[model samples]
Target chain A: MRRGVLAVYQVLLLVLLFAAWHVLVKLEVLSAFFFGEPLQVLARIWEWFASGRIYPHLGITLLETLLAFVIGTLAGLVVGLWLALSDTASRLLDPYIKAVNSMPRVILAPIFAVWFGLGIWSKVVLGVTLVFFIVFFSVYHGVREVSPVLLANARMLGASKRQLLRHVYLPSATAWVFASLHAAVGMAFVGAVIGEYLGSAKGVGYLILQAEGVFDVNTVFAGVLVLTLCALVLDWIVTLAERRLLRWRPAGPGAAQS
Target chain B: MSPQPALALHRVSCRFDARGGGTYVAIEDVSLSVAEGEFVAIVGPTGCGKSTLLNVAAGLLAPTAGAVRVFGEPLLGLNRRAGYLFQTDALLPWRSVRDNVRLGLELRGETDADRLADDWLARVGLGGHGHKYPHELSGGMRKRVALAQTLALDPKMLLMDEPFSALDVQTRALMENELLALWSQDRKSVLFVTHDLEEAISLSDRVVVLSAGPASRPVGEFAIDLPRPRDVSEIRLQPRFVELEQTIWQALKREVLRTYQRAEA
Candidate 1:
């Protein structure tokens, strides 16, 4: 019964927000040209789905995001583990790594376009750059933070160096990597959309860019709403995977009570 | 013919670089041995480097001086013939209870890892808890899983560093009795380290005491004449047990007091 009340309150909040948006636009407190009508934006989104006009664009964006996420995550895991285990190499490369990670990676989108020539590969490259650093740092710290006692115990139990890497280091890093994946996924989407917005023939970002050029505020809002929904869905999938993999963890207080 | 000691540390010393740019000796000239199938407990004041001595025997730390021998062979790298029960929670948090127990066998690439894990878990009295994770269990249960994990490989020697110090008194005694029962069956060499004098006397065939640290060494040793198949809780009531405790505490009290004075200074 409490959950039902919470659900009703949640829906009421969104309804109230949209109602306010509609009222302000109708009263001319906010310009319809700039903000767009709430009903019109919803209708535009509905029409795109009803006519299946958003499928191809959404598919392209999602494909780019997924490819970027997979390649970036794999590269980060391998490089993070390698660098973390090798002390001298990590020490030597420390400053360089910090410099590279600190740069505004969004600026790479235009350069990637120049190199990969406005194709899906350019967007994928940009997305990979955005996702890689988040995972890399997380995994690096994870491997370094492994409990020394646990390592010693494993060694005494006769674990070889290779076995230690596989059983101890990798699993410990995996937990940290999973924790960073939600942000990494969001970064991947941002990279792909920004790449498309800058210069692209396809993707939801391109559709929004086209609508903006023609002053179709409703279509632009519709495109943004669609991307937001897709990002939420992807994040939900990640949370589900995290739950399945991390069943060994004790549930937090909020989850335990529920 | 006499069998060689299961593990021997000869003139062992460990020095650490202090944060203040000077060297600090953790243990100095600490020689000890555990005979085959013998249970030897090392008792000392807190911060007396007892765990450091155990680490040396386990081959996890290389001594600044002296040598370690395992079954009359010079030890190298890790002590492959020994298992270590750490004081802290060393069980892999990502693995379930059964998987943690199977870790040693898995490292060796044994084919029957699952069966061995299940059998050892049952032996440790965690038969129905194989599926639960470490966080789901109580502190005593986690220690049992750690014990099972260490013993699953059937190592010839066990090196435990205050393994039950974190548990409550009742749980600690119960686990001690269980460990004694298991040790009686297998008869593996054990080097148990703890600050609790009663626990050392109750559980061990012999107790070795170390002096206060900066550079700690063995100050005294006593043979416990208690009979076999002893219950750790009930053993303390025996007159002989009390007498032994008194004798050992006389040597230990001085070092413990010296440590306290040093700390105060």
Candidate 2:
């Protein structure tokens, strides 16, 4: 009964928000040129889907996002584990890593375009840069923070160095990495969109850029709404994976049944 | 012919470099031995470095001075012949109860790891709890899983560092009785560390006491002559148990006081 009430309240909130937006535009309190009409934006969205013009661009954007996420996560996991285990190398590279991470990474899109020639690789490279550091730092801290008692117990049980890495370090790091999945995925999407906006002929981001050039406010809003929906779908998938993989964790407030 | 001691620490000393500067001595010139099939408990004040001594015997920490021998052989790296029960929750949180128990066997590449793990879990009174993760279990249940995890490999010796200190009194006594029953079956040489004098006196064949730390060493040792097949709870009511507790506590009290004063200072 409580959950039913909550669901009703959620739908009510969305309805109220859209009604306010429509009222403000109709009253001319907000300029239609800037905010766009709600009905027109919704119709524009319907037209794109009905005509199937959005599919190709959506597919390109998603492909870039996925490729970047996979490559960046793998690179981060390997380097994180390697540096965490090797004290000398981690110490030697400490200042250099910080320097690289601190520099604004979004600026690399133009550089990547120059090198990868405005193809999917440039966008993928940008996405990988954004996703890599988030995963790398989380994994490094995870491996480093494994309980000393657990390590000692494993050693006493006769775990070799390789076995320790496989059984203890990797599993522990995986849990931390999963905790950062939502943020990492979002970063991957940001990288793809920003790269496309800067220099690209394909992708949902490029479609939005084209609409903006013609001052087509309705199409621009439609593109943004589509991207938002896509991000929500991706986040839901990540949540499902997290729930399945982390069954060992105690149920948190979000999972609590009323 | 006399059999060799299962574990021997000769003149073991550990000094840590303090965070600010200089050095701090954890344990100094602490020599001890546990004979084959013997249950020895080291009782001391809180901060007297009892766990440090156990770490030395387990070969997890290299001593600043002296040597450790296992079964008359010089010890190096990890003490492969001994199983250790840590004071804290050391079971892998990501693993289920049975998987935690299976860790040692898996590491050893045993072909029948699952079967052995099930048998050990049953031995620890967690037969149907194999599927539950560590976070799903109670504190006592987690400790039982840790015990099963340690013993699954069938090591020749056991080194437990206050393994039941975190448990409630009732659970601690029950676990103590279960441990005694298990120890009686094969009689593996055991070195148990704790600050509880009654627990030490009730569960051990001999009790060794260490002085207050900065540099701590054994101050006294006593042999417990109580009969076997004893229940830890009932044993406490026995006259001999009370006498042994008093004698050991008398020696331990002075050090405890000294440690308290040092902490306040």
Candidate 3:
């Protein structure tokens, strides 16, 4: 009963905040042209949908984000596993990898545009670069942390190298990979949008950049809101995948949802 | 029992690099033989290399010197013949009870994996519980699954490193009985390691006692003439069981005192 009441209370708070914003705009205490009233923004969003101004942009951004996310995560996981399992590979590449990771990735946005042209490919390249390093570090650490005792036990049971990786190393790294994915999703969007801002003809980032150029603060805020909502949806999808994949994990840890 | 011992350890010694300074000797000049179907237990104070010997026998660790042979075959590079029941359950947390049992067979490329897993799970008294994960099971259940996994491989010998030391007294007794039943079906050569003298005495056919560190060796052995299909309650009452327990305890007590004296010096 208390949970239900809290849910209602949260909805009520959002409504009250919007009502106050609407009243402030009506009294001219807040400038409607600059900030826009809550009702005005809502009408603008509805107009966008009815006139088909939003779908193509939304589609382009979603496609770029997803393609980049898949490519980046897979590349990171495979290479990370290789480096961790091979002592020689890790020793040789350790310093170089760290140097690359520490360098600023955002500066590569304009370079990606020049390399891949002003298309969705440029944004994807930028997004993938951003998402790769986060997942690589997490997976590398996870594989290294596996207990030597457990490895010995598996060997005694006659597990080959490939079998050991499948049974022990992969499962150990899975949780870390899933955690990295949550953060990676946001960075993926940031990379794509920044790429679009620099050179793309479409996508949410381009819309925001155009709004900024015109000094239309209301449209700029709307673009920000749209991107935030999309990120939340992507995060929710990743969480669902995590729950399905990790069904074998025992309950009663800190895994229970609030 | 074969004329040749199921497992033979001849003048085996292992030296490991210690962090602080000089090299640390884990096991040295330890020589013993366990015959087929014979249950042998090694007891000593902590850090006496009892577990290290078990690891060598399981083919998980190489001895710095000497030979360990399983059924006359040198265990120099062999790892597929013996099964290991670890001190910790070591059950994969991501696999269900049934899947954990199937892991060994899956790695070995066995076709009838499910059928083999079911048989082992039933033997371990965990029959109707193939779906539960390790977290859902109690400590004893996890250990039982670990045992079942080892049994499924049909190993020629079993190397257990204090497999039940983590259980409560009552649960441990029950598991010991369960172990005896499993051993009775197809008597595999077992080299069980433990610090508990009474446990070593009640379960094993021969108890091999070890001395303290920096090069510990086999110090004593007792043959348990206790009858087969032994009842846990009756086994405790047997005159021979009590005598063997005391003998092993006495051997262990002396070694433990020496270890403390060496540490302080």
Best by lDDT: 1
Q: Please rank every candidate by lDDT, starting with the best.
A: 1, 2, 3
Which stretches of candidate 3 lie above 4 Å from their native place? A1-36, B262-265
Candidate with more favorable, higher DockQ: 1 or 2: 2
- In the range A1-258, model 3's lDDT, one tens digit per residue, is 587898899899989998998899899999887877676567766777789998899899989999889999998898889999999999999999999999898998898888999999999988898899989999999889888877887777778888899889988888779979989999899988999999889988898899889877777777777888899899989988988998876554445541
Provide the overall lDDT of each model, using Cα atoms, as 2-decimal numbers: 0.92, 0.91, 0.87
lDDT of 2 by residue, A128-153 (tens): 99899889998988899999998998
What's the count of clashing pairs in each model shown?
0, 0, 0
TM-score of chain A of 1: 0.95
Candidate achieving the largest DockQ: 2
Alpha carbon deviation, residue A253, candidate 1 (Å): 5.0
What is the per-residue lDDT of model 1 for residues B28-59, given as tens digits with 9 covering 90 to 100? 99889999999999999999999899888888
For model 1, what is the error of residue A36's alpha carbon versus the real structure, in angstroms, after optimal superposition? 1.6
Mind giving the per-residue lDDT tens digits that candidate 1 earns over A175-199?
8888889899899899889999999
| Candidate 3 local lDDT, B154-261, one digit each (tens) | 998898999999999899999999999899999998999998888887888888889999798999887887878886756998887888777768888999999999
| C-alpha DockQ of every model | 0.84, 0.87, 0.67
Instruction: Evaluate residue A177 in candidate 1 and report its C-alpha lDDT on the 0 to 100 scale.
Output: 85
In model 2, the runs with Cα more than 4 Å from the true position are A1-4, A254-258
